[model samples]
Target: MDTLGALALATEPPTDNLMKRNPVGRREPLVTNIMWRNLFVQALYQVAILLIFDFDGVRILRLQNESRSNAEKVTNTFIFNTFVFCQWSICSSII
Candidate 1:
């Protein structure tokens, strides 16, 4: 019983030592400043990309059409086969 009690006490953390080691007051402002600076820089980069890149509505529509056509061609074979099989099964069942 004493050994078990000692083991339990050993497993528990020394909060007093940990509290002394931590410098929460000094680090919070530094971390918050870094986070704000990072966000500001990211916002500036996004604005620059929008201003300099060809990201207009017409270019977006053209890219969407090209992607759709390419995807249709890639999936055409499987789609056609499934449709034909479904139609054949329905006709055979009805007849």
Candidate 2:
């Protein structure tokens, strides 16, 4: 905890010693509270959940049924996220 505390303190204000110590500036926050505002009524909210369950999140989920022994396989969300990130990374690096 001391290390984190030191880093945080060091990064604060003119004391940006931590930022200098490791010169890469940390990423800024992407999402904010304003972006999370719900635009649905009570009726529409339930319908949205039903739609998600019926069609899935852009086919992001799958179920394995061959397991009589409780085995399962699942696509990790990070797998998709990383794929997208790498594509963007390569494209941006080319620039």
Candidate 3:
């Protein structure tokens, strides 16, 4: 057999732990194949939204509020707030 086939035969499936008892005898699920697949699907959805949908809040705001005098200030504040929110989200998810 090829090396990849050998490796696959040697290792249990990602969800094997969820299906069977671990060394600790707990049946709780850790990170599993389903979780990884869900994460991958979410990432693809986000990428599709970003690329095909062209959902830009700043552009929409500028187009909708052209007469507003504080457009630059509003856009700058929006960008800063978005950056902070993304940073917070990533950090929280990691923890």
Candidate 4:
């Protein structure tokens, strides 16, 4: 067997430690998967609204205000806050 085959054959399985089992964090659905998935979806929705605003279009945040869905509002707020923090960090690093 070659080096690649040898490495594959030598790999050991993970231990049965449920407490330290979160290897992928939010990417894998062990814990906090529902929250992460919702946040991701909200981020995508926010991005779509921003894209609409980019080329001389109407702002969608106003329309969101007219809706009675608390979940949607919370998701939009989370996405917006996440973006702002990212922008702040990027700008701070450059300054």
lDDT of 4 by residue, 10-94 (tens): 6745567944875565555554778688668767876775555543222334444454566456556755675676556544543
- Per-candidate TM-scores read 0.28, 0.22, 0.35, 0.30
In model 1, residue pairs whose N, Cα or C atoms come closer than 3 Å (at least 3 residues apart or on different chains), thus clashing, are none
TM-score of 2: 0.22
- Model 4: per-residue Cα lDDT at residue 77: 70
Quick one: ranking by TM-score, best first?
3, 4, 1, 2
What is the model-wide C-alpha lDDT for candidate 3?
0.58
The predictions' CA RMSDs to the true structure, in order, are 22.0, 12.5, 11.9, 15.2
Worst 10 residues of 2 by lDDT: 66-75
Per residue, candidate 3 scores C-alpha lDDT tens digits across 51-82 of 43234654766545564447656665666665
lDDT preference between candidates 2 and 4, better one: 4
Worst 10 residues of 3 by lDDT: 49-58
| Per-candidate local distance difference test | 0.54, 0.47, 0.58, 0.55
- lDDT value, candidate 1, whole model: 0.54
Question: Over 4 Å off in model 2, which ranges?
Answer: 1-75
Residue 14 error, candidate 4, Å: 55
Measured by TM-score, how close is model 4 to the native structure? Answer: 0.30
The Cα RMSD of model 3 versus the native structure comes to 11.9
* Tens digits of lDDT, candidate 1, 17-94: 787895678546655777788668756765554443333423533445557566445345444554566545534543
Best by TM-score: 3
Per-residue lDDT tens digits for candidate 2, residues 1-95, read 24555576667677466456755446744544554443234336555554554455335443443342322223334345545564454345434
